[model samples]
Target: MPSGPWKNLSADFCGPLPTGEYLFVVIDEYSRFPVVEIVKSTSANETIPIVDKLISIFGLPKVIKTDNGSPFNSHAFKEFAENTGFHHRRITPRWPKTNSQAESFNKPMMKAVLAARIERRNWQQEPFKFFRQYRGTPHPSTGFAPFSLLFNRETRTKLPQVPTYKPNAVDECARQNDEVAKRKMKQNATFNNSPNDIHCGDVVLMKNEQKNNKLAPNLDPKPYNVVAKKGGMVTVSSTSGMEKNVTRNTSCFKRIPNTLAPGSVEPEVAEGEELILERKDEQVPISDSKSMPMQNAAPTLAPETIPKSKPTVQFSDKRTTPASNVTEPYITRSGRIVRKPAVF
Candidate 1:
């Protein structure tokens, strides 16, 4: 026999600290009937009492499956299960699919919370109100409200209802008709096909290393579109019109149904000096002109002056000399001519 709804809770409220808004969801595996409880916290110590109350109301199931979380693995839970004689099963570490029954309920519950948050914007204080609305609603599959399924009747509410005559016979006939219509609809919608073969105009997904530079050597799936078909090879075109021939085998390309066309794949251009020059006629000098030989103008150097530390002694007593005696000569320190000056 199929299992009942996966029962678990998640914390969805975020605040300066956690608002303690925990989501408790129970889904029927066969009917998908959901019974959710939104509470401030679901600590094992705190949750034990809540679970006890729920079990008291719904009766203990043969088995309960949950993730390997601290609350589920707590000694209190273990002892409670042992005493109650309810089989407790925990999912393997890091494996969420093992507990998919609970995880699947998260999608619609989250959608409800999001919708409520958008409408009210202050959902933290009124989580229970949303939970009540969700629980009281009729499930699509079971054709029974969660409250009705759990309690065997419609729960009382403050809302007004129009007076109507009780016609149980008429209601039963209407339900039968609805069930027949639903069965017919399901039968008509069923499709039989192996999960392969690219359909014409069906946006088939493919992976090409030539398209994705970062893809590893191993044939991990990437995304491309099937543009045209020829025998076993399909002509695949990227958003950029870069076409490639691919095999129909699923090992080569994983087909993703109902995906939006990917954005254009821009061709990767290599950036280099040659490319830059091609784009713009701008030249950058590699070396300075001084480093290379210049065709014109000699390079000039200035004279260097030497400095003497000692002062020269003056031996001559007479200070003045006649113009005729002041001949153009090179005089030594003893006043003797060292050499006659050459005529210009």
Candidate 2:
């Protein structure tokens, strides 16, 4: 997670609510400020525009976290990340907790959406109300409204105006927040057995992330023997002597004990080919976002979609060629050479 506002953002598909539509939910990791856009599709094509909308409002993020869903895994998104100069990191399949920040808010948000549906209110209007309440209220963990954390000011709402609260309240809130987090961590530690660091020759079961295929196994049938460990990443090769070697994030695999029955052997795979999604390095040109720099006085603009259009290029300079039939003289910036009357 980034330590500053808008430095790192995580996005995920929210729903097929009553409308059968999805919401593209993006949150600033540092401030917890959320942006939930009602969207028609969750495909790469739809996601790129919504991401661009976020950039235009809050400036560009340095990194984006996403799942291995097709929207984030597409080649087009890889190109978009390269163009924006942001690293795109994908969380492991079946590991929603890795992206807890977004997922935590998502639960409450969906609950709100569902409640709106049950109340028979125009659910379409519920998202804005949720956004206002969520941003205006102080977060228990940070003891600050997400709006204040992100914008350094109170969101102007219908509530009565009041003086700034005391510093003691902020300090006490921080202490309470720390206590809550510690208690939660202690409870999780009771049942959570963090995986011991893996090493070369250790058999591991890789996640089978094949989409649209219900017949696929949850874990790949053949276990792979890790060949190397690089901090939080590992490179592994199949134990059956097949060439289906791959490098994936540490969370994407589970250690497979030898006591289990030997799995069916997998067919040989190409050396450079990959069975799952992995980060790709690419480069492309990108224009800077329209958002003002954070150091400047922030503008009071609501986050919304802005249509993009291809720039129209017009050249005022004209070209001259000596091979042409016409006898026009070349012009210079200083002055077209005053030519003596042609003595034809």
Candidate 3:
């Protein structure tokens, strides 16, 4: 639980409504009061404005918790969180339980939506009523109504008319919340937490959540070496030298038993000064084109066949010939051939 209302808030998207829209739900961790916004598109551009509108009305939260959704993970949202001076906590991928409060809230909210749909009621108006009623009702864990805790006053409702009741003191509610949280933490601590404490150099098979290819397995068959571990995140380098940082809870990585302990045997190094596949001055011909560059292969065009030059045929200017100097064979008036003039 948060120390105060709106200090720690969780947000999520619940959707595919009848209209194919999504509901962006934001809830106060301590008060359990929720604010739902309808969104046509979940893109960062669209989501940031909606969240900004809500945050403007209510003061900024110290920490904003969200799942690894596109809008939440987007650069725009990250920048928004930075500019607004709030810590953004992204829950482990594929593990909604990491943000249990948000996930739990999503269930009841969706159920109510479905029920309202079945009844053919005015669903758009239902969220407001639901939020109002939920705020008024006392929570089982907190033992105080969200409205009373948040506003320090009992919310007016259509219930039976009675005298005004005083709200629970904030300090008293906080103390009670701390105690309940402590109890729950102790209960959860009973479960084994060995996976959470991964050490560097540990070989683990990280979960494969990437679904780009359908044929890929769910978990990596090959083991990866853990290079770094920071809180719930670990940086693992695969056997093929690819490295990735993944959430500890989301990956659910398991250790692979090693036959040989690390550093027990010195890794093999090339004994000679030269590497096995090192390039040499001497070029040895090989049958395969890949092994060698095919130096002896036939050239595209043979040297002899390649014509060095063509015979030059220089011609006098054909246009300079005088038409008058040219002799013309002509038919005479009586069909006799005409000849060059004797005087010429």
- Residue 104 C-alpha lDDT in model 2: 93
Name the 10 consecutive residues with the lowest summed lDDT in model 2.
277-286
- Looking at model 1, which ten-residue stretch has the lowest summed lDDT? 299-308
Every candidate's lDDT: 0.55, 0.75, 0.72
For model 2, the local distance difference test gives 0.75
lDDT accuracy of residue 219 in candidate 2 = 84
Pairs in clash, predicted candidate 3? none
Model 2: lDDT of residue 251 = 80
Per-residue error (Å), model 2, residue 276: 99
Q: Residue 293 in candidate 1 has what lDDT?
A: 22
Candidate 3: RMSD to truth:
31.3
Better of 1 and 3 by lDDT: 3
Q: Deviation in angstroms for 318 in model 2? A: 99
Clashes of 1: 2
